[model samples]
Target: MKNIFKFWKKYSFVLLIAFITLSLFDLRFALAAVICMAAPVFSAVFKGRFWCGNLCPRGNFYDNVVAKFSRKKKVPEFLKSYLFRVLVLVLMMTVFILGIKQNWGDLYGIGLVFYRMIVITTIIGIVMSFVYNHRTWCHFCPMGTISSLVSKSRKNKHVLNVSADCVSCKICERQCSLGIIPYEYKGELLNHADCIQCGKCAVVCPKNAIGYKST
Candidate 1:
């Protein structure tokens, strides 16, 4: 299971690119797109934004394509705020709903809507890649926002946690693509609303202090 997840984390982008390429000629891609889009909802219920961390094509795109050329600037303070994150999510959903309504009841029209959404998102990813750290757009993604909310509401589950060995080195903070400061939450489950459960904190901890614990 661990190796399977590692493989997905490493090569999921290739799958994403292949799916996008196939979507150009096949309607089956639309169904795949729907499933991909809905995956976060289900995965979040069990594992926070694990889908974003491991399987999201958009995230994979940022990791593989944008990060290589990214300027890696610190993300703006406003973009990390809950208010701003929710607002961006609302705006994106509004646009999606309006687009669907405008093309109501036609399969081809719906497919075009999904296609255009992907194109626009790719453009946003390109622009964000040049301006900020890789996965900056993810900080404000609607699906991610929703997943985080669900994860926050759940309790008594195994979640990422920090231990007493933490020395406040801040290495985990730097490793976090979403800007969470794990060491700051030492001795407790790191349940920040934006935590995607990516496990980078665990991977980067020199003391080997961070891991999942029932909380």
Candidate 2:
């Protein structure tokens, strides 16, 4: 089970590749992006953004592939500001719903809408990754924001707790892809809305200070 999870973490980016490539020949493959879109929100009901950290194909692509080219700088402040994120969420959702309605039952046309969405967003995300952190796009991604919102109502969602053994070395800060500094969260039940529950911080904590918990 562990190895299977590892394999998935390592190779799930291929789904992104296949979707972009094969869809050129058969746009019906564009529907596959729905899996990418819906999976994160569904999982967020139980574990905030867990799918973004572990299973999102585009996220995997950014971490595994785009990271190699990224400057790895801190994401810009305005991009992560509450108003900005909300605006992005509203705009993207509005556009997506309008497109879906416009195309309605025309399979080919709807597929084109999805195709355009994926290609354009992927291109923009890739460009942003090069200019900033690999996960820069994730800071305000519509799907990611929705997942975080969904997790807010779940009382028993997963979180990372800092144990008394913690030495506050701050090493976990470096491992987080979206700048979620785990060591900085001092509470016994720390569930930062943006935290993706990747457990990378827990793995690297020399003091064995961090563990999964629930609020």
For model 2, residues 1-215, the per-residue Cα lDDT tens digits are: 99988888888999889998989999899988888888899988887888988888888888789989998888878988768989998988889889999999987788888999989888888999888888888888888888878876674346678777777888989887788777676656557778887788999999878887542
Which has the greatest TM-score? Answer: 2
Model 1, 1-215: lDDT tens digits are 98997777777878767766877887446546677678987888877777887688778778767789988788888987779989988888898899789978877677777877776777787798798888888887778888878887874255688988899999898888787899988898887767777787899899989998643
lDDT of 1 at 202: 97
Pairs that collide in candidate 1 are none
Tell me the TM-score of model 2.
Answer: 0.94
Per-model TM-score on C-alpha atoms? 0.91, 0.94
Judged by lDDT, which candidate is best? Answer: 2
How much lDDT does candidate 1 score? 0.79
Among all windows of ten consecutive residues in candidate 1, which has the lowest summed lDDT? 27-36
lDDT of 2: 0.83
Name model 1 segments beyond 4 Å from true: none
Q: After superposition, how far is residue 87 of candidate 1 from its true place, in Å?
A: 2.4
Per-candidate total of colliding backbone pairs: 0, 0
Off by over 4 Å in 2: 213-215
